[model samples]
Target chain A: MKLTILFGGASFEHEISIVSAITLKEKLAGFDLKFVFCDSDHTFYLIEPAKMKAVTFSKGAYKKMPLLTLAQGSFVQKSMFSKIQHNNIVLNLIHGADGEDGTIAALFDFYSVKYIGPRVDACIFSYDKRYTKYLCEAIGVKYVKYEIIHKNEHCNITIPYPFIVKPASLGSSIGVSVVKDESELDYALDVAFEFDDTLIVEPFLEGVKEYNLAGYYANGTMHYSIVEEPKKEEFLDFEKKYMDFSRSEQVLQADVSEELTLRLKTNFEKVYQGLFEGALIRCDFFVFNNEVLLNEINPIPGSMANYLFEDFTASLEELASSLPHSKRPKVTYDYIHSISQAKGK
Target chain B: MKLTILFGGASFEHEISIVSAITLKEKLAGFDLKFVFCDSDHTFYLIEPAKMKAVTFSKGAYKKMPLLTLAQGSFVQKSMFSKIQHNNIVLNLIHGADGEDGTIAALFDFYSVKYIGPRVDACIFSYDKRYTKYLCEAIGVKYVKYEIIHKNEHCNITIPYPFIVKPASLGSSIGVSVVKDESELDYALDVAFEFDDTLIVEPFLEGVKEYNLAGYYANGTMHYSIVEEPKKEEFLDFEKKYMDFSRSEQVLQADVSEELTLRLKTNFEKVYQGLFEGALIRCDFFVFNNEVLLNEINPIPGSMANYLFEDFTASLEELASSLPHSKRPKVTYDYIHSISQAKGK
Candidate 1:
């Protein structure tokens, strides 16, 4: 099967996607891998997998990677490799914006390409932090108190102090800041506005422990991985970038109480079912005083959430094999189509 | 200016969109018009404007429309026209699903093409009836009482006996049924399920008058068209489709009381600003017992809502000219880029 690994998107988390793609390539070695590198400007580049892997985070090494463009639905390079080839499945590892935010997924759908990820509507639904909060509230899930601030609006801290400010649509905590006091509020708002016109300000959950659960849906049932807790400071400040972020800080099968774990898992499944489809997603939660509050829903998490599941390679192989049968829910307007045709006639 | 009128999308409302494009083409005659016809299969075709207008909704005429495929960044025909050309602007007239639901908007964004419509997040937020209700609830806008019914769940009628069952994401009146009692529940559910996995049941607003307000955003302010009330039966049933629906039944600048008109305009502006950014949108409302309630938000309404405005052609000309300046809010994460680069080094 021809499996295309798509990475490097027009998102702030571009490097993270590249890292995730590298990890996926190594894990899914059994399949024929094709690489599609999406530039920050949204241009498609068909990169050589070996050359893409060899890049050592240096400007010179990046320049040497083979790049190709799409011509008639095929990935094409001008000189030697002049033809384009279609993929049986596109394992999209591109994080944020064009990739995880439904742009690329929609493009794949336009080409009738089978890709492993959530549908366009699902991706767009959860892309905004404000929308996610509304979804959580609708599902009766406990969430932190929040307020949406528009860029043109005056700076009035209606919510209490010591709250975190975030760009509404960004992922991987790119433009996020914890306003410790009134003095830091202005700077935080300024920083947040630089990333998005719409900002979400939520009160900092005191004594909150961050826990993540990765899950996927297959054959009409939801499956989940063991929950992992990331040992971090009270707040994940914007200054503490995600690039240098290490998985070593996470405690696999976290030593949380059984009751709390059960609640987290249950809520995770509920959110996954409500807001997502097709993709393997990671749901982050804040556990405090026996309450599980959903922090974020990562539709395309770092590494496609390969680290969370046990036997990542086996799980991926199973997922890839099931891609042909794992269909996304599509609306069939058979009645409407006929009605429309009759009206046209 | 080079303007491409995109229509006939992969949606239940495909025929309506073609009608809308035909109107747009006639209204905006001053601009250089190019028609990009998107079939139900998502294949794009470049049809001559005169040929497109000549077609009387006939299957033979549609079959003869020039079909084209994308080659790199350009639309290409197989023989005689193999090169690609870019349009200065894309007037997206496609309604529902891949069109109005944000799929094509995201695709246009991916290709850095400026198109007339709301962005992905806003479209998805309003596309889902349940989410739109939540947003209205959050913003303190009065709305009809509704209950969400997920697939695989037992058929439970929580709302009142006289209620409407509708697919959450569909536009127009497709897969929508008015259930007056228990006997009609199963048939309504079956019809609704044919369109989507999730369905919404809302109480049938008794003695409600349907009013619609179409508007667009320009230079940081929302502009409006005349309010029109469609004269229809109590329920806009599936049998009474929108295609055969007549605009002649509508009372232009509806003669509602001044107080009611004020409320409608105010609510319209609030919903427009809160829920949408770009494009001319039509907000549907139900006025019952002096209470104004939001019914639906049509991101890409039929005829581009040309009939609502007093000077339809002038509005199109002005809107088309201002497309370059009428920008959507975007995030600029300057800090994250530098941080990512430094971390990579």
Candidate 2:
């Protein structure tokens, strides 16, 4: 099957996206594949009949392609996608559009392509912090109180000093800052503006413990995940999360009361299904003073959070087979079938 | 200041975008304008300043530009945007991306560009249905029972049959459908998916009438506006509300009791400040059984719903000027200046 995996958006999380894409491809090796990727530096690659072999583009000069920027000039018209072989399903493996949000997914809709991910509305909702927070509240899940700092406007920074300032749409803590005082608010806003325009300023949880939950949905059945207490040094940001060696620690599970774990599972599923398509989501939350506060839902998690599911022993193969393969046969009989069905045929 | 008016996205409302861009241009004649547009097709256009001619390449097009096929090597990248004149605000004249949603505004944050719209979180919450309904419920506002259809799942369309389906992320009545029978559910979903993947299905309200309240925020003050009754053939769809001749039956100053109207206005302003930051929003609701069920909020209404102020005989110029234009320039300078100061420039 000629299924294509789109990854590595124009986000700060580009390199990690590469890791995620490669891992996803390896897991899906049983199917014929096409590797679609782009990087932060803007280098892009598409692997036809994707494999471990090295690929080079060298007609005149050697260079790679970037996915976000399609070809310029002549072919940049409406008919561009019309000629491409659409797969049975498109699995979005990238994040941070820095939450480029729903553009790629929307493009899939524009092409009438069948894709496996949250719909554009869900993607849009999942991408923005403010909306995600409300969805959590709607479903009776706990989340922190967040005040929005509008673009080009003063935030009043009055939500008590020691607050967290970060880009609302970004994940992986790309443009996150802990503002301890009035002096730091300006710097926090400046750094955050680098990643996203809108900022969510929420009171810092005094003693926060972070946990991650992963869910997979296949044909209307939801598999609530075991929550993992991330084993990390301090708080990890972009470099710490992706640069591998920089990570002081990483953990797949933590021991907790069965009831609390079940609650986490229930909360994660409620937030996932209550707000978006019951597909796959990596729901993150924080526990402060024994109260769980929703952080956000990642519609498409990095590397599909391959590390998170190890505790359940759900091998990549098992997970891959559980969901329908998006790959398609190189040759299609649709056109011929249509022709034969015609009156004159 | 060298500024761009980024408009015309790959949305069902693309044509109305053209009108919005042209109108913005007609009003922004005094500014140094750079026209950035997403065409009727997939092409992104950079209208040259000299003759207002469409240019083949854009600054950041390099990242966005790629050869149609990987076999066709060394795809030219439209990577010009990295060098756009510094400190320019993008007059995001586009809608559905909602302009106010964090993504485009986050672009402003990335480039330090000033923009006009509701705050990012406000935009996020306002445009989302699940959250909007929750906020309404939180504040004692009435709404209909709704269920979210997770992406591509089967349901007994019978329960919600006689239901209205709408795209979550999209504003305006585009990609909306009413299903009266079980057989129509799939067709309704097929149409709803055209605009967005997330479909919001609610029991269609068949009570009384439809009303829109034009709201604005200036000097941190929320202002109530006259309630407008949309004179249309049906609930707002792109063709019904945005088409060139769709306003032939435009209704203004919808006749209702003063006491009821005053209560709506008071409650609307309260909800607006608490749930949204209004650059401007068109609040739509259904008047059924002597009760008002707040339907949703359009943070970025088509043409900014300028027609709502028709009774005041306010010229487009007067209404447009009332918007935060001058404040934007100062806000732009403040952010840049703050960044410079933080950088020890």
Candidate 3:
């Protein structure tokens, strides 16, 4: 099947998405790959695969390419009397808002475009931190205790002095702040509220062991990736995360006991089973007091989390083939026909 | 404001949506109205306001109208050199799947189109019955006891003998069955599974007092319609709901004690606050044993539930003006620029 790499959304992570698309162009060289760029303005453009470089986008040269419009089930470039349709299955490579937050997923479903990514409901569950907490509660998965605060609400800091403040709907730590004391609380909340109207605040645990696992379900079975314990200081802030998103080399797997591994994998599967289908996602976990606590879900992980897998390309192909089919209700219009018959129209 | 009525989705309730559009064209007669029809094939067409009748869609004559494409922030009809843009704020009148199931809302939000309907998260919470149950749990609202059964799973009748079986994701009564005994269970499960992969089963209560309340939040306050007590038999089947969707006359207010009315209104507010913003939604509740239990949420109700309101057009205008603006994270490429400067690029 032809694969179209969709990148660059109207998101704060637009540049990061460009980096991911460029990295994929090198990794997935054996596939019939096509590149489509969505500008921050939400317009689509078809770019040459040879031009898949960070400089090509950073220099604003992609705008000179063919302008495309999303039609019924494909992207089309139109002339006076003819239109060229690109009907390849889209690999949603945009990292944040429009891609992982259910905007593009919904648009693609509405137009009947087949794509490899989270569906609308999955995006809804994973995109917002508050919803993720509720999902963990519903599925019996342990998550860090957090309280949500909306903008303009009273600053009731019940969690404690040292806490983590994050924008509820953002990815990549764009507006995350670790408050060390009471003096830093207002600054952290103001920064977070700049990114989102809602903020989720959780108690900051010192020296938490963080493990990242990436995988996808395909061919009637789950494919697991080696978990990596990311080596970072305190937390990954925006600059460190910007550098982290561009990494493509495989890292050393986390060294842990079999029992701990089983526990982590069990919690991961519980989170991924029914909610995440047709998408390769990464879930970060915090292991504290011999319990696995889900941190957050990366619905569209950077570089597709290719570094975590042993054979990413083969697994992607299997996932593409085993994508869930939308259960479209058979619209026979029988009721309308019966109504028309009753009216004698 | 120019209001565009979008009807006819690729859903089982496509006919009901057409009836809703036709009814709105009559009740909202004083407003500047335009009609757009989405055929079951997922193609869009522009129809004349005078042709907003069930016969126009039932006979497939809408296919002959001007073909339209959804461009950025508006719907457009294109010719050789130029395109005519219909920049009206769309009133999402399409019921069921594409309308109430977060498809159209996500598409509209992606393309920056101004619309009056449930946002994506709200649609996610209200469209599926299982998710609605989770939502009730999150918000501390009272809902009926239920069990979810997936297709191909063991047929476990954990609930009592007499219960209502419903397709989890479908709206209206298309794939709903009331099984009075074990013999009727298989047929009900089969019918419900044909419509959706998941089914939500709830115990059937005899002589349950059902009440429907419709409302929308706008201009810093909640505006509620008169609570309606629908007069029906055992349950509203497809044929009964078919006749119900086309009613344009105002429904009579339910006569109940002030205390009971307050309880219903309080539950409705809890469900609608922060979740069903920017859309007029109807909540159906069952008062059993003096406790109000939420049955389901109609995110995009038939005829916008205008029959329940005192001044439907004015409330609609207020909602249109007070629609929630998406919190777009400022995409300043500061991080990228800083990285580039550090590398001396």
TM-score head-to-head 2 vs 3, winner: 3
User: Which model is ahead, 2 or 3, in terms of lDDT?
Assistant: 3
Interface RMSD of 1: 5.9
Q: Score the docking of each candidate (DockQ).
A: 0.38, 0.09, 0.72
The better candidate by lDDT, 1 or 3, is 3
| TM-score of chain A as modeled in candidate 2 | 0.75
lDDT of 2 by residue, B1-345 (tens): 345666655444555555555554544456677666654333445555443311222223322433112111111123335322323344566676535344444334323345556555555567667667877775567887788765667654334457888877666676788888878878888887765657788887655588788776655566666777766454655544555311322345878789878767876776676445425677887778877778788776665565566432233323334444211111012222343466576
Tens digit of per-residue lDDT, candidate 3, span B1-345: 579989989888998998888888888889999888888778889999878877778778888899887878899998888899998999998898998889999888877889999999999999999889888888888899899898887878699979999999888888999999989988998899888888999999887999999999999999889999998688788888988888888888899888988988899999998788989999999999988999999999988899999889999999999998976655556666677788898
- Reproduced native contacts, each prediction: 0.30, 0.06, 0.73
lDDT of 1 by residue, B1-345 (tens): 567888877676666666667766766677788988877656677877787652433353555656765533455566564555655577778778777677777777766677777777668767888878887877777888888898889867777789999999887888898899889989999989987889999888777888989887766566788888876776665445454322322236888787887888899888877557557888999988878999988887876777788876666556655553322233244444575577693
Per-residue error for A344 in candidate 2, Å, reads 34
Model 1 stretches astray by more than 4 angstroms: A54-82, A237-251, A321-345, B29-31, B53-57, B60-65, B69-86, B237-251, B321-345
TM-score of chain A of each: 0.85, 0.75, 0.96
**Worst lDDT window (10 residues) for model 2 chain A?**
A53-62
Q: CA lDDT, every prediction?
A: 0.72, 0.58, 0.88
**How would you class the docking of model 2?**
incorrect
Candidate with the greatest lDDT versus the true structure: 3
- Model 1 complex DockQ against the native: 0.38
